[model samples]
Target chain A: MRQIKLKERPDGMPSAKTFQYENVDVPSRNRDEVLLKTLYLSVDPYMRGRMSTGPSYAAPFKVGEPLNGGIVAQVMESETEELKEGDIVTGALPWQEYIVADPNQLRRPEVHGAPVSSALGVLGMPGLTAYFGMYHIGEPKEGETVVVSAAAGAVGSIAGQLAKKRGARVVGIVGSQSKGDYIVNKLGFDEAVNYKEENVSEALKTKCPDGIDVYFENVGGEISDAVWPLLNTFARVPLCGAIAAYNLSAGESDIGLRVQMPFIKSRVKMQGFIVGDFSEHFREAYEVLSPLVKNGELHFEETIHEGFDKVPDAFLGLFSGENVGKQLVKVVEPEQ
Target chain B: MRQIKLKERPDGMPSAKTFQYENVDVPSRNRDEVLLKTLYLSVDPYMRGRMSTGPSYAAPFKVGEPLNGGIVAQVMESETEELKEGDIVTGALPWQEYIVADPNQLRRPEVHGAPVSSALGVLGMPGLTAYFGMYHIGEPKEGETVVVSAAAGAVGSIAGQLAKKRGARVVGIVGSQSKGDYIVNKLGFDEAVNYKEENVSEALKTKCPDGIDVYFENVGGEISDAVWPLLNTFARVPLCGAIAAYNLSAGESDIGLRVQMPFIKSRVKMQGFIVGDFSEHFREAYEVLSPLVKNGELHFEETIHEGFDKVPDAFLGLFSGENVGKQLVKVVEPEQ
Candidate 1:
């Protein structure tokens, strides 16, 4: 079996050298345990926070330890009646080719005619994150305008689509023209602002002539500065992530225009949240998202890299806007 | 009669030169109107926002126009049945000794054995500001910790008392030792941090051994920076005012540590609001607050400057932290 471990904590932006590949023997399963072969692994931008020693929602990943994340696996041999051999399950597991896990630690995702890998994207954490943030915090009303940053990424793509479902005038902010087009044309966003090519503030003013009522903040810093002034009275901002500040070097301050004055003037409600904050109601989110996926009312995209060796590169590509939507690594093929 | 007009918009901080006091004729009342004698007027931090041309909750004060704010007045003569001569009322009125207004613009405050001036402080807009911000937004749970900045000011004083009423351990951050003693010894706060004398962050950590669950933010800047790291999971911040950044000169940015990362990690909900946001439910707030004030369960203080000419100086004193509790100007005594 092959695995990847954190070689050393990166000072800022992580490189390929940050991860060390290792070879290990597959361990035998005990009673109530299942021997599993990894199929797909998720590489999310939030994992960057876990890689460093910092104050974050999740505990920091220990150096020299095997890196772990959301993984979809197939049960090769099961000792418990709860999960049988050949059953597909998803769990937070080590980033390795073959591993053993208790059946209780994994869940069988409802495919609903979609690929099993969809569990790592639309039917999983990213989808649930979008569901809670947009539906609960953003609360985009009908006829209101919504602007989403990083609109082509995993969470933002789904978040924008959810806003569209709520009958909001959805405008997406993306890094590239292609991502902008994907969100607007394929994902049905009302407008798209390519931050790379256009002045985000001016472009947003022209696109969102009514002024933004809800801002779905993902990539903070300059993008956030552009959105703040355009916010309408009583605007809601769901602060999901600040990937732009994730790689700031030690002692580097992520300073920008202060939000206090503008926020008070606009009576803005800005709330920072993670998907797990609404864990108790995840079933409600899944009920809402799963139906949209099955009926094709909601659209999603995935940028999958072949082989387990590509995990580090796939994760690194998130910073450079290389992926269109969910970034994943395919470890092995699930047997029919 | 006398009135004060905004002579010119101040470049940064306003001085005596910014106000132009003029002798004017007392306007006569028309049909459905009442002749008002100004008894008391409020000088609030938010009025500073209206002094200059900028994006704010209220429109900027015109250079040649009289500034208006919450004022308690006596009805010298009434042309309608709704009010009569010698009746006391309060309204948002211009900075003048005597004025004419329609009866609909004023509301009779229920004094409940308290002074009529209470209408402009603990029983009026400032009280309502604290009520909605602390009660609805902060929602301090019993046994939880609540921290209030500008703790001796009108809104903060009331807000801290409200949290104490809810059974939460309350801590107040004030600018001076006297103000700190006032919040702790007089207002029943569990602890007080004098930011001018001690390190605010360190003092807060020692006082609030339990992390802060609710923060009533009345001052923004370094005071806010100190509270951010001490926030507990699911902390709620009701941002009522940001006086620290109110006087930033044109083209000067009010920059500070970005709140996105810490907020997300702690799942903080920071909401900016004004009393007007809860206008529909003012009766509900009054019903709850009036009883507390009447029963003497809620204590209040006032720093009343005598004479209408002292209004500008009283307003300026707020920035310098010269006055404790609600700062007001006594324009005249009621003719009993």
Candidate 2:
């Protein structure tokens, strides 16, 4: 079995030297445990926060420990009644070729016609994150202008599509022209902005003449600075991530804009949220999002790496704005 | 009659030139109007937003128009039976010596035992702002650390006291040592940080080892930057004001950290609110706050200026950090 471990904690931007590779034999399952062969490993931006020693909702990975993330695996051996051999399952598995997991920690796959890897991206945590965040916190209304950053990425792509489906005038902000074109032309967004080239705040105002009523915040920093002033009264900002400054380690950056004061003037409601905080809403989110996916109302893209050895390289790409859509790694080929 | 008008919109910080004092005859009272003599003029941080031509939640003051603000007034002539001559009232009144007001625009003194100026400060908009912001948004729990910026100002002072009243550990962030001592020694705060002399972020970590659970944000520039990283899981930030950045006309200052990822990492909930948004909860808030003021459970301080002509100077003092506690301009002498 192959495993990836954290070699050192990164100070600012992480490089390939931050992780180490190891070869080990697959461990046997104990009573109530299921040994599974990993199929797909999820790579997300939130992992950057975990790389730091700062205070966060989730604990950071200790140096030399194998990194763990959401994974889709095929049950190889089951010593539990809840799962049978050959069953496809999902669990928080380490970056390894195989894993021994508690059956309680694993959920049986209900993919139906969708690919198993979909559980790691659009149909899984990222999807539920967009669903709950946009619905519960953002509370996007019909005919309102909905703005989203990282609009062609895993969660953002789905969020923008979902907002468009809800009859909002969806304007997406992306890092590259390719991503921007994808969201506007392919995903049917009303407008798209390449934040790298175009001015986010001005573009939003031009496209959304009525002003942005809902902003699904994926990238924080200059994009937020641009979007803040354009937000209309009673606007809702569902802050999910801030990939822009995740690499900086000189404590927090000091971009002083007096940003929060807009809340009082415009009465804008901006809420920061984590996917794990609203786990109870997972099923509810899936029930609502699944039909949209099958009916082609919601579509997603994945940038998949070939093997477990590539996991570190894929994760490092997150900070450089390299990956398109959800970044993921293929651990082992699925059993027929 | 005397009136204060906006001579010109301020480019950055407001000054005496921004205001113009004029003398005029008082208008005759109409059927629903009551001729009012100004008692107290409330000068608040929010007024800064109104003086600019830039878009804010409230409409900007048109050049050459009288500046309007919350005031405690006395009914001199009542064409409406709702108010009688000699009755003290509070409502939105322009900066003036005497004016005719509609009866529906005013509310009688709700707390007879406490000073009426408290209506504009601790027991009024700023008080209610602190009340709902702390209870409704911040949601302080016992043993949790609640940190408030602008610790000695109108909204934050009351917010810290309210948190302490609820059995929470309250730490205040202030601009000066005297203000810090006032919050800690007089107001019963567990600790205080004078940002001018101390390393705010480092001091905050030492004072709040467990991390901040509730942040009452009043002054938003460097102080907010210091407190952002130390936020604990499920932390609540009630954005009240941005006095520090209110003077900046445009262009972002480098503060070092951006909030995107930190807010998400902590699952922090930052909400912006104006007291008027919760007008429905005004009575509920007043019921709790009034007794606290009357019974001495809650203490308040005011920097009183004598006369309506000083209103402009007092209002401008907000940006300079000149006034202590709730800043008010006394327009009338005490009457029995």
Candidate 3:
């Protein structure tokens, strides 16, 4: 079994040097454990937060231990009656090609005859994060303008789509023209502003004719600077992520006190949240998001990298804005 | 009758040149308007936002118009059946010596036989602001540490007291040592950090032994910088005022984007609100706060700038941190 390890923590924009590749013998299943062979691995922006030693929603990665995140694997051997051999399960697990997981910790997500890779992207943590942030936090009213930063990425795309489902005029902020087209045309967003192409502030003013009422803030930085002044009175901002600050030098500001005045002046309610904080509502999120995803009412995309060795590249590409949607690695093919 | 008019839109802070005092003939009361003799007028941090041009909860003051705010006035003549002559009423009224007021626009606050000026201080806008922000927004639980900025000022003092009433260990951040002493010694706050004298962040780390669960943010500058990182998981911030940012040059960032990472990592909730936004529940706020004032359960202080002409100076002194409590201009004494 092959796994990835954190060799060194990067100061900014993690590179290949931060990771170490290792090989280990596939372990046998224990009484409560299910021996699994990895089928797909998910690399996420939040993993960057786990790299540094600081206060965070999740614990930081131990330097010599195997780095782990969302994984979809097929059960190779099972001692528990809950899961059987050939059954596929998904959850936060180690980055190894094969590993043992407790049956209770993994979920057998119903893919509704869809591809198993969907479990790591559209039907997994990314999907749940978007769903909870949109419905429970953003709470967009019909016909109100809803803006989402990181609009081409996993959570942002789904959040914007769900906002549209709730009858909001959804405008997306993306890094490239192609991604803008993908969100606007393919994902059914009302508008998409290419942040690299045009001045986002002026573009937002034009697109969101009615000032933004709910801002699903994922990539906070200049995008936030543009959205701040345009927020309508009593706007609600579900602060989900700040990918822009993940690579900043220590002591540097991300979306800092700049928001304080705007928040005060407009009576804005900005709530920061992690998906785990809303774990009690995960079943509800799946019930709501699964149907739309299955019925093609909610569109999702993914940028796939082949092989387990490509995991570090997938994570590094996130900072450089390489992926259009959920970035995942195809570790190995699942048996039909 | 004399009134204060906004002379010009200020570039940063309003000076004597931005204000014009006008003398007008005292007019007879209209059938629906009661003739009012202003007794006390409030000068608040929020009024500074009204001085500039931008998107604010309250409309910006139009140049050449009378500057108005929460006022305690004596009815000189009854034009409607709603009010009688000599009745002390409170409302948002012009900063004028004598003016006409609509019965519907004024409130007859219950002061429990306390001074009428209490309507503009402890029992009026500032009091209600602190009351609602603390209860509805901060929602500090018993034994949790609650920190308030601008702690000796009108809103902060009342907020800290209410937090204490809720059984939270209350800590205050004040701009001066004397104000710090006033809050800790007289008001019975658990601790007070003099921001101007000591390292605020370190002071907060020491004073708030359990970390902060609720932060009543009124100043929003260095005080916020100190308060942000100390916020515990799921900490609630009732963003009531930004007095520190009231006089910054246009486009200058005050309390800018430095809070983003801390806010996100801690899953904090920072909600901004004007007192008037809770106007529907004003009666409830008064109901809850009035008895406390009457029973001496809620201690309050006021810095009285005597005479109607002192209203401008009183308003300006707020930016300089000159007041210990609610700053009010005593325009005239109530009728005997």
Task: Please give, for every candidate in the order listed, the TM-score of chain B alone compared with the true chain B.
Answer: 0.76, 0.75, 0.75
Q: Model 2, range A95-183, lDDT digits (tens) per residue?
A: 77779999888886444345566555545556556665666567777898999877766677767766766789999887667666767
lDDT of 3: 0.66
Query: What lDDT tens digits, residue by residue, belong to model 3 across residues A1-336?
Result: 567788887777676667777777877766888888776665666677778887665689999888887767788888788998888788888877778988888987544444455455545556556666676667889999999987777677777877887799999988778777877877788999988889998999999888888888776677777876676655677767766666775766644534443333344453433333444554453454334334543222335565434433543443233443234444333211
Q: What is the lDDT of residue A178 in candidate 2?
A: 68
Off by over 4 Å in 1: A257-336, B257-336
Specify the CAPRI tier of model 2: incorrect
Winner of 1 and 2 under DockQ: 1
Candidate 1 local lDDT, B228-329, one digit each (tens): 777765677776766566666776766653354333333345454333344565445344433433454322233556653443355344323344223444
Which pairs clash in model 1? none
Ranking by DockQ: 1, 3, 2
TM-score (chain A only) of candidate 2: 0.75
* Positional deviation of residue B284's Cα in model 2 after best superposition, in angstroms: 36
Q: Against the true structure, what is each candidate's TM-score?
A: 0.77, 0.73, 0.76
Q: Give candidate 3 regions above 4 Å deviation.
A: A251-336, B255-336
Q: Once superposed on the true structure, which residue ranges of model 2 sit more than 4 Å away at CA?
A: A28-34, A78-80, A249-336, B30-32, B251-336
